[model samples]
Target chain A: MSPNVKHRERNRRAARWLLGLSLVAALFFGVRVGLDMVYWNDPKHHEQQLEPWMTIGYVARSWMLDPRKLRDALALEPVPDRKTSLGHLARQQNIDFETYALRVMDVIARQKAATE
Target chain B: MTEVALEWLPVYGLPVLVLIIGLGCLGAPAPASLTLLICGSLIAAGDFSGAQVYVTSLVAAIFFDHAGYAVGRWGGARLAHWRIPLMDRARHMLKTRGGMAVFLTRWLLAPLGPGVNYMAGVVAMPLRRFTPFDIAGEVVWVTLYLGLGYVFGSYVSQISEVLGDITGFLAFAVLAWLLWRFIRSDLKR
Candidate 1:
């Protein structure tokens, strides 16, 4: 085959492969996102059980609360930096994180009520 | 620096993200994946929607992947033909396992992704094989970082820092490996 003809043939094959791969990738992304949405919307997934190792940043994300506001509401000293997990903060304050997490939940409840 | 660009993410938006990632893939010293993670953080913050960021990032990455490949084809191949130790080893890697090398560099060792793209081109890996695997690898790379950003938006800065360190360490490790291999081969001869 002429060099030009060979090049054209190669390009066509590559294009076909690209289309196939794109389709597979699109399906994978769609399924993953769809599943995450479904799990999030399910009320069963709303289990509010906070673990000791969770950070205020994490709680804010899970609970859809504002991290900054949560910190201010809890009057958390020295500000809750990203690396500071809840368990460490609870220890600093001489309380178990369960009690501390409950207090945060209560604050979130009051804030919601005030907004409502 | 990648972190500095990140601070401007809220102000500058998607175009900036796309540009930085493209250039970074072409051997620019920007932390591309970390930027994606920050973009994910923005998605979580509701500044840009997930689909929009995902599409933009994927296209940008794939576009640059091809560009780097082309660079390797035209530019890097010349060096591969020379008696260079590093180039020879890279050519060997591309010859032995081009697709898996492409995939691994694309996501797992992302800092090396661009270099691999260029090297794959230098070794004349078929575009039919290279492009599809490049896309698949990018899917994982983009999704993982963006997912992290979405889930851990509040801790994005810290995550960026950690990932940057990991990329740096990996890059260093790769360089060290190349140097060691070169010395060992020299001693054998």
Candidate 2:
């Protein structure tokens, strides 16, 4: 084959490989997004893992529960800094992390039940 | 500053992020990757959803990539009059290598982002050829930065600061080297 023909052939092969890779990526992202959406929509998924390090602010926003209501129900001090994780606050207030997790979990469970 | 922005994210939400990223892709000086990283940290911290942050940043980046492409498309030959690094080389790559050039620059030498977008337009790369590679490249960029933030959420503030300092120093070093090269070339001539 001529040099020009060889170059064109190489380009065509590259394009084909790119197209195949792109299709695989699209399929992967689609399935991942679908699974995430289903997981997020299911209330049970929220309770699956309640880590001590999670913040009150994070929990409120994720569950669509009111921060003020959740705090009050849990009888917690005002957390002005949203980044303050539950584990840190529990230590500061001399409260057990497990107790903190359980209280927040209870509130989350109640909120989910009310919505359903 | 990243902390301040992170704190505001939940209050301001996705619109702010989308706007900033769009502007950054259009050649505006903004901390686009840093913003994605912060969003990722927030998602990992449970302050925001991972899917939402990913989707928002992707759309904004791709939209602005198109805008930059449009500007290049409209400017055409006139863009060649402007001085930019690797302009001639980029034009050649776009012509010879095609969309793979677009894909590589999207994540690799991301600082040259706007330059590549504009060059693609100036060279009249077809929209069909540009869009797919652009989207795929953006996915890699978004996911990589976000994943870093998610895994290192607790240490993100320090990580961003260190990265920022390094980026600034590198940019200065590159510019100084380029200036020196230009002067040497002129002297040689």
Which pairs of residues collide in model 2? Answer: none
User: Candidate 2: global Cα-lDDT?
Assistant: 0.68
Determine which window of 10 residues in candidate 2 chain A has minimal summed lDDT. A45-54
* Highest-DockQ candidate: 2
- Tens digits of per-residue lDDT for model 1, A1-116: 99766755564454445445544544554455556557657888545565443456556766677777877887875442444556566667898757977887798787677657
Per-residue lDDT over A1-116 for candidate 2, one digit per residue giving the tens place of the 0 to 100 score: 99766755564454445445544544554555556557557777544344443566656755667877877776776666555666665666798868867767888899778778
Candidate 1 TM-score over all chains jointly? 0.59
- Tell me the lDDT of model 2 at B58: 93
Best by lDDT: 1
Model 2 per-residue lDDT at B78: 83
Stretches of candidate 2 off by over 4 Å are A1-116, B1-6, B80-89, B161-189
